[model samples]
Structure formats: structure tokens, C-alpha cells
Target: MSSSEVECGPSFPELIRRKRDGGQLSKQEIGAFMRGITSGSIQEGQIGAMLMAIWQKGMVAEETVALTQEMMHSGEVLQWPKAWDGLVVDKHSTGGVGDKISLSLAPALAACGVKVPMISGRGLAHTGGTLDKLESIPGFTVTQPVEKIRQILEDVGCCIVGQTETLVPADRVMYALRDATSTVDSLPLITGSILSKKGAEGLNALVLDVKFGKAALYKDLDSARGLAQSMVTVGNGMGIRTGAVLSRMDAPIGRMVGNTLEVCEALECLKGQGPDDLEELVKSLGGYLLWMSGRTASLEQGQEALAKVLHNGAALQKFEAMLQAQGVSADIARSLCSSQCDYFLHLKPAEHKTELTAQSDGTVVDIDGMVLAQVLHALGAGRTKAGEPINHSVGAELLVILGQKVKKGEPWLRIHYDSPAPNAKQHSDLQAALLVGKADSYLASPRVAEFILPPKM
Candidate 1:
């Protein structure tokens, strides 16, 4: 069928056929599909078939833009007229293993005088989610209403909340269906889902950290670049200035991965004492957002401004203040530890410690991010369903990083787990996943791979 013939609320077979045959969908057809899926008028199987077809046939730039706009309009938009003096800026990472840049960057930017209303997601598959990690703190709720979210951003200049059901409800339904149907990786669908929520934020500018490696959703450079380009195209079409950084993911961003552990690492970064690779990424992303917001003329100047906040302890102070305002206390702060996750409930804190003694260690060559995340998942460190609670206290600690020297029979990395959950399978998975090599081995890994810029057109 031609675009004009495809009516709103069309038959499942007709809609499926149009997309499956590489025909364009009218805006009304796309809008109706979103509303139908979200309003329960559409069955899961039909939605799955249509999504599969869209994934196979692909969406053009115009279709992608229309899809994003419809999704954005299905929900409420947030803004702060009086509080934010300059352009309100936000950052998103295409989920990555051990990526906790938001925990630092949000407060760091806010401290630098920009409003950051960050709506984050939870872990799905192998990558960590920002909302899941932030919730590790006691009483640190992510379910605040839109009014409170506005107040929080006004009072503290930043607030991280769970993506409200009312905001981009369409994307929520589509994503759930995509997840079940194995169509979650479609570039246009991914782009629409991401930009819709981000666009609904009423943001002046946005930055994305498009990651590529074994652990990220986009597992290679080509896929990551394609995803980045689609997002930029859609964001620009909607009048939101957008850019992306194609960062390395050969190894995890920081030393930790589980909720609380990663939070502590982010805290360290805000205090100007974080891993080198993680720090570089923070400065790079923070700098880009600053430039987009017109706070800095160049990346170097933005980096220096970010450094002042980190080194002067302003960022850490803002973070603590925000946490306190959000209801987390200092006494219970240690629960942020990767081993203390069991404190929340029937979940037990990780008590078992297994030292991975080096068999013939010269240097640590690689740490597989996906394998590491799977080990945590198997060990009950994270939840499979959105409703499942995480054991935030249980996680791994690396004693030897990549390019670090190690002695034979010495500890390379320590595996910490809450012993209550059965972990026989996870232990084997973790063992096979972490690989170490001889110091004499020649290939040296750079901290960053390449930079992905915004689309010029």
C-alpha cells in the first residue's frame, strides 16, 4: 500500500504487510500503532510481528522523525523557566558495562550552573542502568512525581528520576514488546525510543555516549556509529541540538559494575580520584554538554571548568546535598558497597570471597564486560525483570587491571558474592570470563578508541 492508503488503526495483516514489503507508513499509521500498543488495543503478537517487519525492512529518516514525534507527544514534557539560567542540558549513554558517568556528570554539570533533569533506566540484558545504580542508596527514591521533579531540579539544579509512565508511555510499551520479540536492536526503533523520552525533557541540548564493545548493546563500531547517527538525525529534526561520543568499551569504564560499587566509584571521580579511563570519559562528555549549552567555547575550556568543580570539591558537595535532599543518609551510605547489597531484604550481603589466583600472570590483558555482568546477574547482583530487586551489595573487585603486573599464585581479581543464592554456575562463568596474559604480550590498549561527532547535514 502507498503511504496515503495506510489508514490509522489499520488491520494487523495490512500494517504488517506494508512494513514487511518495505513500504512507508503514514504518520497516522505510526501514531495509531503506538497508541494501540500502549492502550492495550493491540495484541503482543501483532506488535511483535510489526516490529520484526520494521526491523527487517527499516525506517527512513522521515518515518523515524515522525515516530519520535508521536512518542514524544503521547507523554508530558518538563521544563524549568525560572531556575535554569542557561540552556538545560542532559546526557545519555547507550547502556554500557561499568558506565557510571551520569552519577558524576549530572551533579558536576549542575554544580557548573546547568539544570540536569535526568530520566534513567534500569539494567536489561548485560548493561547496567542509571536508575538501578542510583537506587542502591537507602531511601534514595526514583519515583518522584513531575512536580517534585521540577522542584528538585529547581532546588538542586539536578534530579535523577525513573522514566515516568506518563512520559513517553508509547516507548515503554514498544520497548517491552521489542525486548520480548528480539527486535530491541533495530536502529530506527532504538533511535525513536531514546529521542522521544529525551526530546520530551524540553532540553536545549543533549549529549550521548555511544559505547561499543562486548558489553554494550551496540557491540561493534559500525553498529554504534549507525545508532549514533540515527539519534542525532532524529534529535535535530525535533529541534534539539544533539551530539554523540563514540567511546571505547573494550574494558569496563570503572573498576566496579554493581549498583553501590559503581556509585562509590563515581563519588571518587567527583572527588578527582577515579580511574584514568573513566575520568577521561567524564571530562569528554561533560565538556561536550557544556559546549552545547554555550558555557564554554571549546572542549579544553570545558574540561578545565569541570576540573575546577571536581578538584575544588564543589561537585561532591552538590551530590551529597542532592542525596540528602532526596532522603539518603550518611550512616547507611556504605550500603553503596558492592558487597553490602543484601541489606535491603531477604537478599543476603555478599560474604563469600574467592581470590582468582594467577596461574601464569605477567599482566592483565582483558576483562570481558559482558561476561562480568552475566556473572553478577547469575550471582543475584541484578534483576532480570523490572520488578525484581537487586542485591546491590554483591559485586566483583579487580586487583589487577589491564596492563598491570601480576605475580603467579597471587590474586588477580577478587570475586565477592552473597553466599545465600546458589552460584555454582556463576562462579564458573566468572572464572572463564576474566582473562589475564603475560606482561611481554605486545598489544597495548588505548584508554579511548575514537570520537563520534554529530551529523553535519
Candidate 2:
């Protein structure tokens, strides 16, 4: 049939069958199909079917690359001048609850002389997006024109823009279809969508934070490692120096979870006093990025340099500078926090009163990440659908971490919510997600995960 006769260029059923049967598609065919979907020429149902097929059969590296290029071409690619060059380093994280490390890491890296053009997103599942947390700061604008992004990067050494419709528009369409069809769990599709946006931005080096746990989307070490490897491979293939770091999500990253509250916690990290896990993750990722960018010779050197930036208070200054460059009013920073309370600057009161304590008082063993996230979501810290406003005051502030001793009457964690609706929903869910066992129930960490480097082409 002629191109004109085929409405979306290729029949949806035919393309779905081709991929489902492990057949390869030429770049043009895949591009045409994605273009049709994003342009509304193809029905959402057809697009959904294609997503499911791709998820099940998987895409070859070539197909994944083609898909990435097509999605990137579906939107505008950002441009920057050579004079603004200082190795631009940025980071991406797989979705997980309490994954707010980027909020502090970006500024800390920028303070160390790297230009960070950080594009962030909002909450998708249980984990919150960097843009959403930054939005909690009054009047901070995540939306900026491409030129404005470059300008802010040039002047302040950093900028965090929201995922825009004008950039990677095809991925935008595909992501929604995948979410609707339950095909989002596929590793190939996930890697393509994640890397396409980061690659399209044209950075010198990139760092990926791949998290796995009940609270994380990957859910286990093996799955998370595969994703990390794929992202690094694809990224390096596209000529971007990419490194992946696996992080623990057995519990929340810090003491806070809501937007404003997480922002406060992030501020604490920039000031060099945050949770041990959160700080370690941020420093490790930042160190790798710095090394990839050639700002430092090795991870040890990069960590040493990052430490000086933190110790001298330059990291906090860079963070405030980037916030101002992005149009956050000066008072927004001051009003949200200082050196005092890390939970909330104003100590916003919550109406709910509940705690999940260890009943038997053994070593804290397993905390279901997904269950904890769901409880918080039901309590209104996250959205049930797209465009839903997040309740910045509602989330969990964890007190007891893994392997910590907990007495029977001691509070394990505090649930914060403003009203009756979420209180009734969160209390029971929170209690059930935590499984406390005897001394031998302690979780073990992986001695080593896969290394992510460019293949021997």
C-alpha cells in the first residue's frame, strides 16, 4: 500500500506483530510509527499495543538506539555555545520513594566548577521528582526556554528545568501509553526513555542513580543492575560519558518525604549535614560525574574536591545562586530553611498522630518499599494521576533505620498528614509494610554490582 493509503504510515497490528515476533524494524519504520503516535495519527490503543509488544519481546540495541533517536527527533534538541563550556555534568535517577539526592548533588557539583544543566521531573510512582521538590520553594520556576537554560548554566553554573513538551515529545507520548498499558516495567523501553531525554540534552558526562527495593520501581538488584548497564551502554554509544551507581532504598533516603520537607532535607545536605545514606549516594554520584567530566582523575580525587566545596560553604551558595537564576525569589530560600530544623523551616503542624513501632524489638529487618510508598501516596504526598497537585505537608519522617535497635514503645517513624482522610488510610498501611524479625533477619548488601562502561566496539 502507498504511504497515503496507510494513515499512520504502518498498520499498528502489523508493526506490533513484527516486534512481538522478535523481528527487527528499520530506523525509518520505527521513526514513522512513533511520529504517527505523537502526532495523533495513530490511536492510543494501537500505541498501547505496540508498547506491550516491545515490552514483552524486547528491542535489540540497534532498535533501542533507533527508538531513542526518533523520540529525540520528535522534539527540539537544546543548543549551547562552545564558550559556555566547562564539562557539563548532570544526573538521572530511576524512580524510588525518598530519592531526593539530586536536589543537593547538582548544586554541590556546580559549586565545584561544573556547569550543571539539570532537567528534572515530578513524581511518577512513589518516588518524588526533583522538579516537584524544587517547586515547593515559593515562586521557583522549573519551566525555562532552552536558551534560558543555557544562559542560567553559563551564569550560575547550574539550572534545573522541568521536562518540557518541546523536548523529547515522542518519549512523552510513549511514556503515557506505557504507564496506561502496564508496560513501563520493561527494561529496554525504560532505558530508551530515560537516556533519550538525557542524551538529547547534549551533556559532556552523565551520572545515573539506579535504585532497587520494594519502594523502587526496579524492585531488586538484578533488574536495577541491568537497567544501569543499559543506560551506561546507550549513553556511551551516543558519545556521552555515563556512569551508573546502585543505591539502597530499603528505607527512605532521609528523614523527610514531602516536597517542602524534602527540600529542607536537601538543603541540609548541601550544608554538609544530612542523612548518612543520602549524603553517601550524592557524593558518590557526584564524584563519578566529576571523574567522567575529567574535572578529577579518579573517584577519590573527585570526592576530596567535593568535600572542599561542601566544607567551605560554597555548595550552599551555588544552590542559592541556581535557585535565583531559575527565578526563585531570595526569600523563598530563607523562608524554607536555615541551619536549625531540617524537617520544615516553619515546623508546619499536622493533624494526624500515628507511629509504627517495633512490636517485638528485634533488629529492624525488612521494610516494603512499595507498601511504604503506597501509604504515603494514599496520604496525599503523591498523585493518583497526571497533573495532580502534591500535598507538600503530607509524608513520612523516618526515625528508625535498618539494623537499628528499637524498643517496643519507641517510635519507629512519624506519619504526617493534615486531615482525617489520609490519617485513616496511612496508619494501617504503614504498620503492615514493616516486617520486623529476630537478630538474623538483617538485610545484606551486594558486595559488587556490574560495572557500566562503553562496549568494545
Candidate 3:
């Protein structure tokens, strides 16, 4: 069937055929499609086939917008209290190694007097997920119902939870099919999947961390920018303030990479004492969000506001409160945020640990995050497919900074693992991730490459 012949209540095969032949689906057809997904009127195999068709033929901007709106309304659309008017905001990242910014950013934004109902996901490919990192904390839960999410946000100003069965039900089915069908990279599909969940949140503003590099979804700045612009457009068109940051992801965002270790690093950042790169990312993403939400006079002022809370113990207090609100014991949350808490004693640690030393001495210039992530993923730190179990303790700690000079045989990386330590080949790959160069040749750069802002609305 051609585009014009595909009616609102068209047959499933014809709907698929129209999209497969590059015909743009009408809004009513998209809405009908979403209804089928949520009501189980559509089979999984048919959904997978349709996803492949959409991946190959692609959807126009209007079709993407319609799809997102339908998916968002497929289930419950959260209705926050009217007092939250322009205060609801959230940020999302397109997965990256050692990317734990969400762990601290949410609470920090909350400290600035905004509502953050953060609905996050699990690890995808080589990058870690926000919910997975939060799960590493003892007693921390990510499956809050909408009412409970609202309660948590009301009390603590923030809550990071995953999708409940009734929230964004359309994306839940379609998202699973995308991975199985190898259509995970489709631009319109990704936009709909991401925005549908955020749209369900009833957010006032959103910021996207579109990363590009060896370990990111997009391998170059231009491609990342394109994705950033697409999301920005759709988000703004939906009446939400939206923007994006194009960040480089060649190296890990923070010094640690693993489930529990990332939680520890995030706590350190919450306490105002972690890697500078992590701090920069939080400020950039959070600042723009604050500005777009109308909480600050300007972006710079917003950044300063976020940094002030981050450094003045305000954000830490909010994080502690949020933890307790989300099922963590008050004592454990307090100790974890205390100045002298030993993380391994409070949180779980790996069964075995080993350190890799530098083979030659020079200024550290680069660390290939992809190589490190792959090795850790093999060590059971991450999953190869959805539903696979991962070892929370499997992770790595970078001992040296990118621009720091090192001596030969210096311990540069500490690997935390279980059962079997890294085999000979894994050890070599981890060591090869480091690159040393002349001291003067190494130049530190910003993790944020550029910002993609929506047109004035």
C-alpha cells in the first residue's frame, strides 16, 4: 500500500509495508500503532519486523514527534502538582564509559530548588547505565511507582528510578525489539524511545549529553551534533525546553569504571572531590538545564549556582536524603556521604584485585576508554545482552591523570575482579589503553565539545 492508501486503522502488514517502502506514517496511524503495542494487539515478531522497516526507511520529524507523543501516552502521563510548574527538569546521556554524572547531577540540581524525576536505564553496549550504578548501593532501589516517585521528588527534590510497566509502555516493548533486531541506532527510533520516557515525566526542561568518541555511540563530533540537533528539535516542538551538549568520550568521564566503583566515585563527586572532567560535565549539563528551566539569570549564573551547591555540602545533603527516601538506610546514607567513610567497608568489593603498571615512563596523553570498557565487560562488569547478570564489583580505577608524568613500572590502573583475575591477553589490552608522550606535547582539553541549543520558542 502507498502512503495515501494507508488509513488510520490500516492492516498491520500494510502499515509495515508502507514504512518499509519509505512512506511517512500519519499521526493517527502512529497512535494506532502505539495502542497495538500497549494493548498486546501486536505480536513481538511483528514488532521486530516493523522496527527493522522503520530503521531502514526512517521517519520524518513530524512522524517522530507523533510517535513520541503516542508512546508517551501509551500508559500513564505523570501529573505532578501544579506547584512544580517550571521547576521539573532532567538530563540524559547517550551512554559512555565511566559516565556517572547522573548519580550526582540529579541531587545537585535538586539542591538548587528544582524537581528531578530521573527515569534512567541499564547499560547499553560498552557504556554503563545510571540505574545499574545506583543499584550498586546497598538497599538502593530503582523501581518506584509514579506516586512513589512523586512523593520522593516532593520530599527530596529528586529521585532516579527506572520505567515501571505502566510508564511509557510502548517504548518498553519497542526498545526491547530494537536491541534484538539490531535497529538500536535508528535516529528517529532513538529519539522516540528517549523522549517518550521523558515526556511521560511531564518535565519542564531536558538536557542531553550526546557523546562522541571511541567509546560513545557516535564516533565523531559532527555525527554526535546531528543526533543532538534531532533530539533538541523534537523536544522543543513538544513544548519542553530542550538542549544538548556534544562531549568527547575517548577517555572515561571519571577515574573509576564499574558498578559499585562508579557509585563510590559519584559519592566523591557529590562531596565535591572527584575528577575535574566529571565536575565539568555535571556543571555544563546542569547549568544549561537550570537556565532552560528559568531558575537562573543566565547559563553562567546557573553553572555557578550548581557548583556552589556541589561544593557547599548542600548537594551532598540532598543526595543523602534522596538515598534514604529511595530505600537506603539513613545510617548507611549518612556514613557514605561522611568525610572519612571507607567505601569498600560500607559497599561490596571484588573478590580479587590487581594493579597494572606502566611499561615506560612519560606524560600520559590518552587512555582508550573502549579498550578498558571491553575488558571490564568481559570480566562480568557489564552485560552482553539484556537480562544478563553483571558483577557489581568488576571495575577499574585509573591511578594517573591524562596530563600527569609517570615513571616506568608505576602502578597506573587497579583492576577489581572476581574468581579469575585478568588473563594474559586481558592484562595486555588494559595496559595498551594508556598512552605516554613528551610532557610538553600533552594538552588537557574540555570534555564538552559544544552545545546544541533549540531555536527560540
On lDDT, the leading prediction is: 3
Query: Which pairs of residues clash in candidate 1, taking residues 3 or more apart in a chain or in different chains?
Result: 338-393, 339-393, 340-393, 341-393
lDDT by residue for model 3 (1-457), tens: 3222323467777889889999988889888777777777777877888899989998888998998899999988888999999999999899899999999899999999999999988996698988889888889999987788989999999999988887887887888789889999999999998998999899999999999999988999999988899899999878889999999999998899999999999999988897899999999999999999988878899899989998999999999999999989988999999999998877899988899999898999999999999999988898988788888899999999899999999999999999667999999998889999898888888999898887872
Residue 203 shift from truth in candidate 1, angstroms: 1.3
Clashes of each: 4, 3, 0
Residue pairs of candidate 3 with colliding backbone atoms: none
What is the TM-score (0 to 1) of candidate 1? 0.89
Q: lDDT per residue, candidate 2, 1-457, as tens digits?
A: 3222244455667877788888888788888787776677777777887888888888887788788777877888766778645487789987777778888888889888888888888886577878877777667899998888887878788888887778888888888778889997887788889888987787888888887776776778888888888788778766778888877676677777777677777787887877777777777888888888878888878878777776677888888888788876777665444455444444454567566676667777866667777877777778868799877777777777777767787788777777645454556677776667777778655412444544441
For candidate 1, write residues 1-457 as lDDT tens digits: 3222334356756888989999999888888777676666667777889899989999999999999999898878876675464568899988777889999999899888888889888887677778877777667888888888888887888888888868988887788889899998798888988899998998988888888888777678898888888888788888887888887786677787787678778877877877888888888888888877788988789878888898787887778767866777754543432233343442224577677777675677787878888877777777777778777777777776788877788876676677555366766666666666766773765545665555551
The lowest-lDDT stretch of 10 consecutive residues in candidate 1 is 334-343
Q: Which lDDT values do the candidates have, in the order given? A: 0.78, 0.76, 0.90
TM-score of each prediction: 0.89, 0.89, 0.96
Q: Could you list the CA RMSD of all candidates, in the order they appear?
A: 4.1, 3.1, 2.3
What does the lDDT read for residue 378 in candidate 2?
Answer: 73
Off by over 4 Å in 2: 1-17, 38-46, 84-86, 334-337, 341-353, 421-425, 435-451, 455-457
Instruction: Evaluate residue 444 in candidate 1 and report its C-alpha lDDT on the 0 to 100 scale.
Output: 68
